[model samples]
Target chain A: MDKKKRIVIQSIATLLQNANLKGFFTGKIYTGQSKGVCVPGLNCYSCPGAIGACPLGSLQNALSAYKFKLPYYVVGLLLFFGTLLGRLICGFLCPFGFLQDLLHRIPFPVKLKHFRLDKYLRYLKYILLVVLVIVLPICVKMTPFFCKYLCPSGTLAGILLSFRNSALFQAYGKLFTWKVIVLAVILVAGVMIARPFCKYLCPLGAIYGPLNKVSLYRMECDASKCISCGKCSAVCEMCVDPTKDANSAECIRCLQCVHECPTKALRAGIKSKPETSKPSHEGEKVPEGRMRGKD
Target chain B: MRRIGTIICFGISFLLIALGILDHQFQAVLAKAAKVCLECIGIG
Candidate 1:
């Protein structure tokens, strides 16, 4: 998809998930039936306008309640989303991701495309997923650590609701201040780097990242069409080499690489058949060809 | 094989969701979500 189309889809998904307009005016959260259902994106349930639950938040909550029962609902829903669309949800549905995308669009003097620490930093999200989201909640006194301490989307919801509810503003304490600082830093980093949070911090992204390889919707690179011009890697903000690993865990399925491929070798969609390779003769050596490019 | 894998994943997900609902986990999710998540908003 093109940038405009992705933006439009992101906008619609964000708005639809937070469709409780009356709650925004009343400074109250939606308490309807739909609140039980999880949206595919990371929208906070506490948001005054939110009509659906956040999968990450719900998962943490369920994990916290592990003494009572397992988090079957949240886990199942997350698996359902991951197997179906993978990080497509991050690219086209997450409100916070959309916010980051918008922030990255703001003209900056220095856009940090890549840094030496970047590869190492990418593992942080997985650590957070295993620790804060899953382990801590189950081990501790059922505390949703990530939501309580680090979710910028939750912090944004609190800030937005506090605008209309003076009581919520008055209730703000050291924790709120710390959360605000975190949000500010993420937003500022987002202006300098494309999707810093998604790349390095989002637990939801971590969950979906590995699933990209096996998701029903996936990216495929046709070696026959590839000219190894390196256009796809050059355009990928996520630093993924599409020709080398079309279904890399790092890919958000933004489709920019697909659009930028000179040979139209990269494609994204549901695949019906398993990948087939041509047979090679016994003891025969194949010539090296520029079918795939280096990262 | 890829198609089968996708189908198996879908089947497992749906089955899990169904089991969760049967176990009344949906009600638990609904009750929690309906309330103001104090921790989420950094209130407590």
Candidate 2:
């Protein structure tokens, strides 16, 4: 199969029937088989056959007390992957990211400007990543804040698991109300902006972002090859400055740069040279976008 | 080093996945262990 096609298919897989069945098990079932790894993606844990653990949930569980404990292996795993690939996992592996990509396929769209309310809004995720994903769990020690308060994954999982057990419905109360509100917000945002939650609130993205510059796999601009068509930036759904800082924090490492470069001057894969040097010419503007190379 | 990083990424990812599956399959056991060993394994 074609590479892009594979990615599309992978993204679509997030929507299938993946009812979680783990809650039913009351005994030990460790068979010493399976990947034994955490996927560094925002895949719904409730999805049936989900072998990977949710880092956000794990982090909250870990920081539950002042003393705190849980093998740091999961957090360590998240950092290792985030530092190595940044949001490349979102571009390549996350089922939620795939959902956003599909939503972007819709004809009606409103692109956001970087200097507006959007810039300020980006900070919300930092607040979320720090407080909800980290601080709250440290303080509360009762429930997963993001899962109970904001994650859509819980809803997706709940619909699968709770629908079967009526007692589960009775078990739901304030926690369910809180999660539904968050899901409603996420759902509404998906309809409005291309990726409102991803753009503004995912903690994992916030973690992976700073590592984009240092990551081994990255996007690069061949300044030496010539041409400054702004098409790359215009085509970017993430609103990143591809030519100026192709692998900057804002970039999700999606292949839009590779797809939109008319000059074939831009490439995505790895860093070619040290990027500390400033561009010799800064004001030159290229055509808004170069279309046609998604696959 | 790059190869090591790549191998580690693959290894660690699978490890977490395996652990999650174990927790799922043995939810009761892990939950019980979590009670006795909340801070024991460094998972608060």
Score each candidate by Cα lDDT.
0.86, 0.59
Q: What is the TM-score of each predicted model, taking all chains together?
A: 0.93, 0.72
Candidate 2's displacement at residue A170, Å, is: 3.4
What lDDT score goes with residue A195 in model 2? 74
Alpha-carbon deviation at A16 in model 2, angstroms:
11
lDDT of model number 2: 0.59
- Give the top-scoring candidate (lDDT): 1
Candidate 2 lDDT over residue span A23-44, tens digit each: 3342111222222344677754
TM of chain B, each: 0.91, 0.52
Report, for candidate 1, the interface RMSD. 3.1
Best by DockQ: 1
